[model samples]
Target: MSTVVQDRSSAGPLLAKTAIVTGAARRLGSHIALALARHGANVVIHYHRSASQAAQLARQMTQLGVRAWTIQADLADAAQVEALAARSIEASGGVDILINNASFWPEDTIWDMTAQTLQTCMDVHVMAPVILARALARQQREGHIINILDTRVTDYDHKHISYHLAKRTLHTITRILALELAPRVAINAVAPGLILPPDGYGTEYLARLASTNPMNRYGQPEDVVEAVLFLLRSRFITGQVIYVDGGFHMRHQLYV
Candidate 1:
């Protein structure tokens, strides 16, 4: 099993600010939401098929002494994405932060990859973030948008061609949006590495990959959360991709 690290620190209240976390039901998304709520931000936990998990997360946040709610939306659907932004605005008065953590990663060799698979990855990873950011920017309210990117963007992986391509496109979006949303809303990315194995990956495989990092250990979700908090609180930083990857990218090909 993958190692787990938890932070039990007490955080001051965000004083009723609102944040929307896409795919907040499980894994990294859940961790991010809890971190923001612990600091006093009311979170809107969005999930598509993880309804029960989303509800449970909301309850957990409420127990932390702040408002929390769940919204179900398939982000790949442009309409649903727009509705999500609208609903969040209606409930929270205005969204102060948007975390685009939801993504789809499917493994297929280039020859076996279908157009549908490629399109799906692009839609969720690229199009959704762009659309969501645009909608939020139009609100004319000051806000922050964080895109969750993969560490592989800095070091390409040939196996997951479709997924990598989509993520690369997202990186481009981050740069363009940071310039476009400038002076009002900050746009940045957190590229995590081996924090949690991709869903369905086994423990042995994860352990092997962890050993490849220069730190010789996999990163915890809290590591990424720390980077996120830094970006969110830093009033001066924008258009940067912070890698919370345990120095995994610093080393060249291990076997070459």
Candidate 2:
């Protein structure tokens, strides 16, 4: 099982602000939402088919003494993406933070990857965040945008070619948006690696991969979450990517 971060903090680092965290129904996304709410930020939890989970997580965050609501949208649909951004802005009165943490990871080699799968990857991982960021800029919302990228964005995993391709494109988009939405809104990315093991896997599964990174160990979700908090704390830190990967991203390998 992955390590968990309970919502017990009493600090109010994000008091009176609102955040919209994509894919906040479960797993690491739920942890991030809880952390933001613990810091006094009202959170809008976004999910697609996980309606019950999203609602329950929203209620849990509200128990942290912060406003929390759930929104549903198919991130793979352009129109739904637009509506998500618009509705969130209307409901939150202006979003102070946007965390593009939703993911659609599937294993497909470059040779067997389909155009349709690739397009879905682009829509969910790349364009959805772009649309939300553009909406924020159009609304003149002054806040931070943190894109959740993978440490494998450099094409290390030849198995998940489409996923890596889309994430790599998002890596580039983060920099471009930072330049385009300067001063008023800052943009950055957090690339995480080996933070959680796959389903049905346990600690030994993670420990076996310790040698894959320079630190010789995996990290937890809170490790990635802290890097996010650091970025949010600064107004001058835009267009930067913090790798919370136990230095696994520094390992050099091509299409492994």
Candidate 3:
């Protein structure tokens, strides 16, 4: 297990603001939502099928003395993506932050990857995020947008070809959108590596990968949260990809 750091400070850095975090029903998304709520931000926890989990998380966050609600949408659908933003804005009055964290990671080699799978990757990881960012821009003139990316974007993952392709496209999108939405909304990304084990894997899986990381450790969800907070709190930073991957990216071969 990665280091668990529970923030007990009463800072409330995001006081009176609203944040919409996609895939916030569990895992890293849940941690991100609670972190923001802990800082006094009302959170819109978005989920697709985890209805019960989403509601439970919303209730837990609300108990923290902040407003929290859950919204459901299949990110693979364009119309649903649009409705997600609209509903979130309506529920929270306005969205001050957007975190694109939902994704589908299926294990498949390049030879077995299908066009349909690739399209779903693009729809979920790239298209939906673009839609939400644009919608948030329309709703709030000034805010922060943080995309939860994979550290593999800096390297190759033949086993997850389609997933990697979509994430790499998102990596580029983050930079472009940051420039387009600059001076009003700062767009950035946090690339996590060896943080949590992939779905269907155990802690041992991450522990094995951790040994290969330069830091010789696995990262906690809170580490990613800290990077996000730094980006959101900054006034002059935008269009940057912060790797919370324990120096794994530095060791990856860059194709310059």
Candidate 4:
């Protein structure tokens, strides 16, 4: 990382800082990584299977005048998750921001929910975040941790029961970690709503779902990135969830 200090009085307030964003190869994670890099933070882009995409993203981020590294890790694997944090620390010299943006959005109804599938969801949404947070705490003090969450907590998703339950668990974990890592690290979350369509869905699906929000429109990835940036730049805020959803959480509609 370059030690030369530039006048960060500009929009890039996080100049010279380092951030780790999981599942950053594409989609919303990719947008978040680019936003952080645009704001002058060196990024560690974590991916599970998108090696080529991740490398391309790193190159683009570096082209923005910030350092970027790609790390592949299956969030479901505890060992790989741990190794990701370790490698990020070694590569960046130390981590100043940690964004738990990787998640598994499983589609299983209550009757269809199996032990194996439930365990996998829990491993990614709940267990992996806790492990990464603990590792980041050990690597650096006075940093920020942002968990990427969904707006379904206020509503219900019967079709994705296992995934919904795991995310709720992660929501609680965020608050608990905020208390546990207080004064050393500030932890918070950004709950996104209608930001991106699921794997099989199309733009029409998102357009139909947009009615659930009072805004009557879909949100862009930049909305979530702005929420993440707010949490990262503010030192006094912690354990809060900024819903980037277009008032959908307020309506309590089914997201799945």
How well does model 2 score by local distance difference test? 0.87
Q: What's the candidate order when arranged by decreasing TM-score?
A: 4, 3, 2, 1
List candidate 3 stretches off by more than 4 Å. 1-12, 253-256
Model 4 / residue 148 / CA error / Å: 0.7
Instruction: Report the C-alpha lDDT of model 4 over 48-145, residue by residue, as the tens digit.
Output: 99999999999888777889999999999999988998899998899989899888877899888999999999999998899989988886577999
User: How high is each candidate's TM-score?
Assistant: 0.91, 0.92, 0.93, 0.93
Can you write out model 2's per-residue Cα lDDT over 25-100, one digit (the tens) per residue? Answer: 9888988888888777889999998899999988777666678889999999999999998889888888989999
lDDT of each: 0.85, 0.87, 0.88, 0.88
Better of 1 and 4 by lDDT: 4
Q: Which ten residues in a row are the worst by lDDT in model 1?
A: 1-10
Ranked by lDDT, top first: 3, 4, 2, 1
Model 3: pairs clashing at backbone N, Cα or C within 3 Å: none
Question: Candidate 1, clashing residue pairs?
Answer: 14-40
Q: Point out where model 4 deviates above 4 Å.
A: 1-12, 252-256
Clashing pairs in 2: none
